[model samples]
Target: MTDFKYETVLSEIVEDGVRCITLNRPDRLNAMNRGLIDDVARAFEDANADQKTRAIIFTGAGKAFCAGDDRREHVHPTCEEEARDLVLAIQRSTYAIVLNHKPVVGAINGWAVGGGFEWAINCDFPIWGESARGFFPEVSLNLFVTGGVSSLLPVLVGLNTAREMLFLGERYDATQLQAMGVAWKTVSDPELMGTARSTARRLADLPPLSVRAMKRVLNATALTDLRRAMDLETEATIAGFMDPETTRRLKDF
Candidate 1:
């Protein structure tokens, strides 16, 4: 893989040909600040272009996989222009991951809240740690989810279950997510990295062209509405950020 440097993310080649990109913000539980968001997007884009990178394993450096957006860094947008810009910037990470050529495996270690949870689902294969937890707190926070979740989620779990998850913003354990078909596997926290490495190794051993073709075909078939969902989410999220109530709520938090 190419030698890439990032402030909020760590990238390295591991497991023969797997690119391990770690979200690095231990003090903030790997929150998605603008720097982190941009770093993630760049890392995936670099991996996509690097012929040596056969697969990717995404994880967090600290306890939590990602705690959504960093309240301090992601200030509430004061105007429509700011909100639209922020929404587009935030969505870049999703586009990078979903559109990448190589397969991605999420090593979800801990909390995957809000946008963090959306990213986990965006992975081609998501392997959760036993203690991992996921939830959508966007509705409660006067915010909205992105990452094409509006379309991807309902397919993983039925519309009714998806409604419960999104509308209620309830937390679900790793086992629960696996049962819901959102997680490909749930392993003990100690085994999370090992499992991810093994999974990536298997993917790396496959014929690159065949694997890429299959991924493209699958995405084309199942995610026909992904772009539409992302557009709708961007609009909704920008509106949410522009609301004065959202600013007030964010301040209180």
Candidate 2:
């Protein structure tokens, strides 16, 4: 992990063979920009390949875990090719987390909106702070979600609940999400990182080979269409970007 460097992410080995990766754009509430998204993808890939890093604790730096895209400073693709590249780069972060060999523990400290909520779902264990909230704002923004959530959400909370979450874009508190089986546990803000670190420690202590095997087997059996769903979502999102209505909506937002 020491050999790797990132512009919008901070990686360091925590105790008990666990690596803690923090999203570093606190000024922007860690919103997903090109640099942050690329850094997250590379960071997870590096952690997956590092044998010494047994588990990963993923969290944000400030009040919000991630405010989704940096709407104010967001990049706009001028053409379909640029839109495809942007969408692919956004999807790559989710791939790194979901397909990583090592387990990822999410410390959802605050608002996990849109893409941030999708990333939280991508974690093997998502722990939320009591005050944290989550919701899908993609539909409202004239965009679609990435992160294979198109396949995973319905399975986690059922088809009806998933539709409500995605279509209505209402916020759900930490306790509510835990009850829906989307969050593993909810703790106070002060305990958020500690709980996540403890969870990572437990994972680190497990038999690595067995854990990895279980993850691969479970994903293979349960999420067989994950890649397809992601691909579809990417294409849909590209269409959203190319639509003039989306540009108008973004401007109004």
Candidate 3:
């Protein structure tokens, strides 16, 4: 972490062993492009390996936690390899959080749309702000959810609820996600960072080895399906990316 100077994100370790990683592209509402995606993967990898950091708190720097992928920079791949690589980069970034030995928490300051929702949900759990909005505009935009959400989301919110979010490309506020039993807590915007850091510190105070073992066991059992679903999603996304209909729809949107 010391050698790398991150451009799309900022990282600092707090006194209580909680490292805060704030997505830094405020002008773009902290949207995920290649740089942000790579930085996230690298940051989480470093945080997990850092003995001084016991838990991580992820948030965004400006009005939004993340506005999702930067669509203006989004690419439509011409070949299968390019398509798969693009999707895989995205997949790896999300998986990096899961791969961490320490617990990860998201503090959603505002918008968490599309891939942003994936990032939020990928954390062990998320503490959201009251003003935060979550949604998947992917279907309309001719894209698919990049993470293993195809498997994980249905488990949290039920199949029908997942369908509403995925198929219909619907929006859900923080309160609604909290009610659905997805979000950990909903705090006022001003309390977002404080609440997130407090929670991370609490988690960091647990027996370190036990916490790591617990996470490993939980992931092995709970994420078995997620691994398979992510693979399928990647393959399908690449094929879909080249579809004429999808291309036309993407351009229209």
lDDT against the true structure, each candidate: 0.90, 0.91, 0.85
Which digits, one per residue and each the tens of the lDDT, describe model 1 over residues 50-75?
A: 88899999999889999988887876
Candidate 2 C-alpha error for residue 101, in Å: 1.1
Residue 114's lDDT in candidate 3: 83
Candidate that beats the other on lDDT, 1 or 2, i.e. the better one: 2
Clashes of each: 0, 0, 0
Name the top lDDT candidate.
2
- Order of quality (lDDT): 2, 1, 3
Off by over 4 Å in 1: none
* Residue 196, candidate 2: alpha-carbon lDDT: 92
Per-candidate TM equals: 0.97, 0.97, 0.95
User: What lDDT tens digits, residue by residue, belong to model 2 across residues 166-218?
Assistant: 99998999999999989989999999898998899999999999989988888
Lowest summed lDDT window (length 10), candidate 1: 69-78
lDDT of 3 by residue, 1-253 (tens): 3333588988887656888888999999998888998888888887887888889899998899899878788767888888887889888877888756789989988899888899999888699999999998877766678788898798889999999999998789999999986798999988988888889989999999999998888988877787889988888778778777888887676
